[model samples]
Target: MKSSDKRKKRLPKPLLSDMEEIEMDVLSLEEKISYISESLFNTDDLKIRELTFNNKKMVILFIDSVIDNRNLQLNVIKPIIEKSAGDIQNVVNSNNVKETVYLDEALCAMVDGHCLLLMEDSDVLTYICIPKVMRDRSEPINEKVIRGSHQSFTENITENIHLIRERISTPMLTVKYSSLGKTSKTKYAVVYLSHLTNPEIVKTIEERISYINVDSVQSPGYFEEFLEDSSFSPFPQYINTERPDRVAGNLMEGRVALVMEGSPTVLLLPVTFFSFFQSTEDYNNRSLIGSFIRFIRLISFIATLCLPAFYIAVISYNYEIIPVEIIFSIKSSLEYVPFPPLIEAAIMQFTLELLREAAVRLPNPVAQTIGVVGGLVIGTAVVEANLVSNTMLIVVAITAISSFVIPSNEMSTSVRILGFPLMILAALFGVFGIVIGLMFLLIHMVNLKSLGHNYLYPLAPLDLNALKDTFVRLPIWLMKERTKDLKPQYMWKMTNPRGWKKNEESK
Candidate 1:
């Protein structure tokens, strides 16, 4: 055989063969019970009760932790015992009642919080839904807004869907469900508007998700990492949010949302770099104020990415660029420090990151205390000990605050991480190195894709119509079309939302 053929033969198979198909068995009641007990290793929580009704032996099986005891008693047991019905399905007041002869299917239903009923001399088994636990729908703690609905998504997928359905209330909205994770069987939903969303984008998302070969999907983060277009890029191609209003807004704009059963965070797909800086509160406020805040966010993005590098360049090799008065003060402060500009910046930035992580991990009250006290104590001690210059301290402080200005925490973290490389380049080649680093960064972003769509849309692709809503919030009437980059099915959102002005002018 050729060497290439040998290499091809060494590759692993494409599909998993771990989950074997089990055939259904036509067994007696005692044999069925024995099979379930053996399959589950006779666990303690697997409660199987035998009851006599109309000279028939009926068996009930369920896991204690996931079942509603009262419902099982009143709906299934009470009706069967009191009514003495031949058909147990008629007496049960449950919505999800089904008959199956497969032991694997019956076991799967019982594991999913359903109660199973088997009668002697009968070839069928019945299962009813009796799930007991659910989390309460509460306001999002992370993505709070001053002027919007307070509700957020919960761990329950059905409740999360209800939250979105309540907001949109349109027949065009559709949700498709599928299971992921071979071992966990984690369920997730792909939701979008059938008439508004691009069909190609939906198909791509579905295919990517369907092809994920994993043993478990513990959270939405797993899906985000697996479904993203580029794994090497630091930037997050998909936007994850806990706010239902934000998901609803994106759905209306012809984007797809992935909501998982066990995760509160919903993933919004085909997002651009600019999408991370947007806030739902932007549209909640006046257009002018919203535009101003967005502009500040954009400035913060630049400052967070380049401030440390710019500081390093100026202090290390381009002191001439700084004003004479400011340069004297900076020089005087640095004269007492023993480390080079690069070392000082690295030390201070690392310390700032440590404090940030510490504050996040601590309790709210303790975190507030640590944030204020730790910064004051550590910053003062370092400066007084001549470890870092005061100017570098101020630069690091400003850079840290600018990173926090970003609306998305994941993007904020990526921006902060991107600064480290830029600072290193600045140390090596001064301003020239900074420029080269920025060029490489720009090239990477230009080439990146979010679900096969440009990552730097409206800026790289140069869509003038979309620019109105990119860096600034134009009046609602002015943004008459959806984002052109997504290739939405319906482009014109409103022909003329401000048509009243034309009538008034003509009169």
Candidate 2:
């Protein structure tokens, strides 16, 4: 055989039969995709269909209900089958006349709520975009708001994108598409403004995502696990929000958003400590009310964290610091109690925890019933038994209520859990122990970084501009610049809400 002929021909193995011979050659796209889909999407629910259009074969694959099949039939199937003789003849006359063509682009377009058209003898597939009718609904439960827009993200990526696009209409708003999950090949998008977003942040995020190797990722939880800067920290680095307005506001402020398919919650990067205490209602109200509410929440946060520990320390070791009347009152209250103050505090704390857990496990009505019954039964029983004093009950109740004052559920839970440790320390070493715990907390928080940005920004790093909006929302007119730490190109989003002429007229 000639050299070219020999290179094309494969040598036969003596032990293997012709039927079992392995071919060392490049596989077609269809064959490769067939192998991958069969191996990866090996489930009863997964649907894959091969249909012919104008004598050209194309494969349609998607998870059921994840796509609207009715729309696909009308837009894609009808378009190809109803084509006249001229259209069929044109593709046949063109280059690369194969009887069947696989259009990957068309498949991707269809995945994004479009219909794909694969023609015979054509490498290019046409994407006939179809507008999917999504079920209009209120905002997601976890992210519900009393004052903001109620449109929540859907399972549909297209609808989610539409929600974001509607809020941020600027051309600078950009979306970069990518896929993860080696087996599922689920599509995800990293959205941010080009001019406003820091290039280094984008690069770091892209690199982190590109390196993810997993079988399948179901929701934002998987993405969070993959992208979190520190796995050990109780404090969340990425802010997860289901509200589009929140996401839009962050994007405008120069933060990036990672939106995944099949997940309503979007992951926000570079969050600071103060952001946790904020709610969407903060901005919707008047400045005076907003600032007051913000201040109250900050105070509540500190109170919740330190109250139990401080109380424990005062009664256990710092009784000398207490006033004579208060000391006499506290002593009288503890006289009937059998246990020490620490033991009493522990009993009350554990009882409250058990009640909270039981309530959460029950249904809404049942949970309410459980809370009332548990509270009444436990509170009465404890005081009657003299295991914990009535005064201690009030303090524990106030502490629990204060914990809930934090708007973010995750932060509240962390604070609740962390309180136990501080309470223990205070009981052992008194006021000095509480101070030590606070110092440690401050150091840890100041050293923390969320996606490479300081977690305690505007306070630890001390940015005057960011402080205007962090602890308090200054009036729109008084605030001219976007957050400086965000590195936004347009520092001045709007010149004072009151125009220059209005200011002059007032003067």
Candidate 3:
């Protein structure tokens, strides 16, 4: 051969043989191992354990990184070696065991936390399910609870499902798992109480999930955006929570939760505008106290979104509406400020947002220090320099505080952003602009749907019966029905919960 032809002949051949192209089962154990090793590019984590069962050679193949070695030995290896001479079916004690002759199937099994067994003179390959390494559950920092269970969902999908099952403890609770993402192949589960959740809603959730086509889905956010009915709406279509207790509670009331592998945050779907206002503390507190807190939260939500705009409107065009005592106090505060009310309020609000963002980015103790010190320094300096009004600073502080009062971070952020447009509108047309802006917002919400369910729920649809649990939560016994907005299969979740009390009264 010529020098050029000799080099081409000496070059390495492709790793995959013609058998793979033909999709034929390779019966030889050594060839199968070679195929897999080459298929994975001879990865460092590939492990092989060889043993003799009654003098018959057997090999175990797995990835060291994906599986728990101790679990594999205790649950699989012990049973097989100790119970030799019997069929593999009777010897292994693993949860799932399957035999396959196809190399592709065996490779997939190995990657999914399974150990493949190949015995001498046997063409069939057996795969046993092995425990996968997973992280332990910890309380979510963002959604803390004072009185309820502190456990939150972990990145492990199975453990998250187990937590929900432990709380509900009923066969009616259903979980359906489906793999998503073409490259990532992320696993996700849809959980709901079958007897309570509407089948149509479940179908809708599934259909929406099926529509997502992506290489990777890293968190619940990807699924949320794909599944949402309105992508442009500022309101979140799902309640993203990590607390298992909170998810269990929502499931009991006939909502669906999407749990994704490798993500701790679970998505509670078809939630309403009011649903964002609820907190886990609401149910833990006494009924009257919870109701008062809910009312305050709703009020604070309004103030968070409209306080700055309202302030701008009053000083710019509706100072006539101000009380005689308060008008002088406000006018005196604004006397030295050179900027218009709009510019002053905007600057203060922007500065507050910067401080808030800094607090989130810094370490906990440092963040607290910066928040307090920064606010005092900025507030004092701005007022003394006649750059911003004292009254405007107060409005910005109240607005920031009110935004924090919102339990859901998504809604809190959206409200903060929506304030700017309302501010512009108010500056242009004053109180009428605020009313007109609010009217358009209401109309949009009324038209918005979350997975085909009303976004504003009982308020927009005016379902009087469901209002009992909307603005204020009634006592557990009195609030027997599930919210109509969810369209739960069973409306009355409780009946005669107080029958014993009624019986005592009769006695």
What would the per-residue lDDT of candidate 2 be over residues 289-397, giving only the tens digit for each residue?
8899889888888888888888889999998987999888888889988887778878888888898899788899999998998899989998888888877888899
lDDT of 1: 0.83
Error of 3 at 426 (Å): 1.1
Error of 3 at 331 (Å): 1.4
- Residues 356-411, candidate 1, lDDT per residue (tens digit)? 99989999999999999999999999999999999999999999899888899999
Question: Model 2: C-alpha RMSD to truth?
Answer: 13.5
TM-score for each of the candidates: 0.74, 0.73, 0.75
Decide which is better by TM-score, 1 or 2. 1
- As a TM-score, model 2 comes out at 0.73
The C-alpha RMSD of each candidate to the native structure, in angstroms, is 14.1, 13.5, 14.3
Q: Which runs of model 2 end up more than 4 angstroms from their true locations?
A: 1-133, 500-507
Candidate with maximal TM-score = 3
For residue 190, model 3's alpha carbon misses the true position, in angstroms, by: 1.4
Of the candidates numbered 1 and 3, which has the greater lDDT value?
Answer: 1
